[model samples]
Target: MLKKVRGTRKKATLGHIRQETVYLAIQALQKDESLSIQLLCEIAGIARSSYYKWLNRKPSACELENEQLTQVMLSIYEKVERTFGYRQLTLHMRKQTGKKINHKRVYRLMKLRGIQSVIRRKRAKYVRSTPQQVAENVLNRKFEATAPNEKWVTNVTEFKYGHGQKAYLSAILDLHDKSIVSYVLGHSNNNPLVFQTLKQALQAAPGSKPMLHSDRGFQYTSLDFKKLLDKNELFQSMSRVGRCIDNGPMESFWGTLKCEKYYLHKYETFQDLKKDVENYIHFYNNERLQAKLNGLSPMEFRNKAA
Candidate 1:
């Protein structure tokens, strides 16, 4: 009769059995000094042998180390609002501790603790412009540049907000450091948008005669656009027709902007969207680290070069 009762109790607790549940059972055992070990184990759905093993076991060295690291990670995650991935977290840890830390270990710790970065998905870019009146693809998929302002890529992207009113963002990216040299936001994606962006880039670095690259957009092919580049004595290059990949670095920038910043929040007004974009661009330029830039921000990379 006793054995049958024990079996029934064990069966009842089996559905709720877990490591945490076992820990609670241990606490319950301590509170009730008169409870039989066998009866307690039966109620916990654990064998008497398992209970004894757990009761006497000590945490391993690895477990202790992980616990310590977990606390450190929790603090770091909170500091960054939990948006950093393992790669950035690894860098942040080293920067915080002033010691070299292995990224793999950080990855392992994040996995074990169920901590992960905010994931934002990338969107595909739409095709723009006709092929006629275009320059040759002189940039030719050569995205890397050894020095600042040696090569520049420009593109226009649209942001729709507030009853589908569109705002155009025209910007130039330096291939050397992946920094935004200049940008303009306006209601229209016109020649003036691209022209003003170019003028600003030249103003910022007047000495650097960069080879400016862009897709064969109407603005790029416009007489005024070509005249402005000629007046500045800067080289003009365009991507191949129907091939956005030829100008991949600029395309990549657009993808990154949409994924990491734009897509994460909602925009109720044009001003609201513009403000967030401005903030995000500043954050991206100064705070966000790029893997290829030796885990440094764009401004940091340029500062080092300068």
Candidate 2:
């Protein structure tokens, strides 16, 4: 050694005397040919009576109960692809098994077993910046409509699967009913898909020229899209660049679609994804409840308006 260290030398001092004694006793027993209660107590620096007391006592009822609870938690975790966290697991236990288990117990059990939900990593993607020649915000964030075809919001959202293949979903939602007036799923993020969706929305709206709102995606701002809007006599409204709140309702719809449906299910093919989307859209329009619509579905709201 370069120098002899003296003083208290607190840098590497053992934190707990009891823990150190326990570890030392374990080490001594491993080296010993046989273990005896008296010898263990001597090595642990504890009284022999205390060691005998621990050996004679049985596990508490609560300890036994925790073992049973842990088994149930393990079963539920295995059943759900290890994706259910404490809250979801608790909910599943109550609903599926009719067990009134405490959340704290579930949390403790999940922690003890090292069972955890997988978190999806956020991916960075290319977002088109708003053009320098920004349009006036005509819609002004008015999301409610008294009848179908009064207000509509359109947006393009991208999805990808496996090896670099991406698909764009362009859709128009009727604010009056919270229903998808039109939607198109396509391989390319081009004007054709956007125009096709708009055409379908116009057809669905029949005689109405709805105020169409959308983020300034190239598809929305293209000459062809503008010409179609002008020919249809529809009011065009663009959201301010990067201001999601300007088009909050459509953003909310997209979030719900991704979180509640898309994130949970994996698609192997574009057609499969399209079919699932179609089914979900139908359910959203005709069956899913909307709190703003007094808990009625989009189709119900439309019928009520009629």
Candidate 3:
């Protein structure tokens, strides 16, 4: 039987006293040569039976493994700068440690240790649609694509900096890789920004008349925009009025970008914010790991497929 417990052992000894506690009291008397067991137990406030029981108790294998797991969780959480929630953290843990873990246990361990990702709330924002009829919902919330450029989604989001100053970002996303094929930023949230993004996407991907989808914003419904689509033989699709979920993937991307990077920083100028946004897009494509992507970045997944 062990005479002493490691420092990590619980101090609570209920039933009989522990051998470790009795040994401790004896050792103290040996060192001091004057303190009695009664005085030691009185000062320690542990009954003799409780101290004896604690010293005799041995840790189970499962309990020992849990301590190890907590350390691993802390290592990975700091390594990623705490960008991942429990799901992604579980993936990283399993990948690095080669240990199969139930995700619920990971969640529990993270909670117990107070290790968690930053939680940021999302809100809905949109431009009002035009009165005229827009393109039909050909895609109809079917976001999957087997090949690049098979389906493309486009949208513009607004950003503010420098006290009431504003900027707009127009981006085109490919359904297959969830990659931003092209993007453009401008002071005006108008036809020019969208057109530039669309044209760049066309040049970059050069798909076989891919279905270009968007909401029925006035920029999308404009005669020139439709003519541009018609001229390029790009089929157009639109979300119905008041249904942002029709563009769920695109909306989710904005929220992820904001939560992971944007909301964490203080941007004093449009130029500084724009540069960081550009850097984040690159990182999202090449460095950031996604749970849906099977632990690969978007570019890594696409390249692996190729």
Candidate 4:
């Protein structure tokens, strides 16, 4: 009956936890009684040889190097507010330390250290709004470009501040190097917000006739917006109705922005939100490295190509 009760009392436990518990028990027993290691091992259900091996083991050179690398990774992870996954962490590590660290090693170390990127928010579906005028999908999801300002993608995203007070961010992203060309944040998702974003981009890069692509939103399809694009000698490309993937790179930038910054914190004031948005865009453009860019930031890649 006692054995039955003992069997019924068993609970599942982790291997390391069980090992630590056995070591503790052995230590306590050794303090009061001179028990042989083998006896203690037998009682603890561990091999006496294994106990001695663990007691005498020293960290290998590889282990020590891993420990140092883990510390470096933790520093980078915290510095970036834990926004990087293993691949980005690996890139940053190699660049910062000038070490050829493998991404798989970084993945293992991150797993062991319980380090991970910030949780990403699920993408929201876009509502198909009626358009005043629509252009053909000339860009046709050709996201890659050979030179700066050769292709641009633009979109407007909504954010909420105090008590559901909404703000809209309209921005254009250059396809060549994944850099944000220009951005405007306002309280209304109106035509001017998007128009200003385009004007800023055009003013920044005058005489650059890029194919400007956008979703079939009211702002993008308006007659005034079309006239502005025509006046600048820019080709206007609109995503087909109900096909959000046609403007995929622009959509991806929004996902990256919200995942890395906006979703991580709450903003009680509009000013604070706006400031954070500006800071994040600057970081995205100047500091944050992309793997596809060979561990260079967006601006770095652009300047290198130039």
Candidate achieving the largest lDDT: 4
Over 1-306, each residue of candidate 1 has an lDDT whose tens digit, in order, gives 999999897665453234535655565776777678787777767778877776678978966775776677788787656767888777667766666778877876776556798776555457665544668788899999999999999999988887778889999999998998888889898888888899999999988888999988889988888888888888989887778898898888887787666766678788888897787788778877787898788999999999
- lDDT, model 2: 0.74
Write the residue-wise lDDT of candidate 4 on 1-306 in tens digits.
998776555432234445755775676687689888788989888888888787678978987898899899999999878888998899889988899999977977776666789777777676677788999999998899999999999999999999999999999999999999999999999999999999999899988999999988889999999999889899999888778899998888898899888988899999999999999999999988898888999999999999
Among residues 3 or more apart in sequence or in different chains, the pairs in candidate 3 whose N, CA or C atoms overlap within 3 Å are: 16-49, 17-49, 17-50, 17-51, 17-52, 17-53, 18-51, 18-52, 18-53, 19-52
Off by over 4 Å in 1: 1-84, 117-128
Per-model TM-score versus the true fold: 0.75, 0.61, 0.74, 0.83
Whose TM-score is greatest here?
A: 4
Off by over 4 Å in 4: 1-56
lDDT of 2 by residue, 1-306 (tens): 324342233223332334434644554575685777567668667787665564466868975776777787778777545655677566555544566777766876666555777565453456685453335679999888877899999988887765667888899998887888899999998889999999998888788988999888887777777788889999889998778788888887777666545777777788878886788788678766565675567898888889
Each prediction's Cα lDDT score? Answer: 0.80, 0.74, 0.79, 0.88
Worst 10 residues of 1 by lDDT: 12-21
lDDT of 3: 0.79
Q: How does model 4 fare in lDDT?
A: 0.88
Location of the lowest summed lDDT over 10 successive residues in candidate 4:
8-17
Write the number of the candidate with greater lDDT, choosing between 2 and 4.
4
Runs in model 3 deviating more than 4 A are 1-72, 75-81, 97-99, 124-133
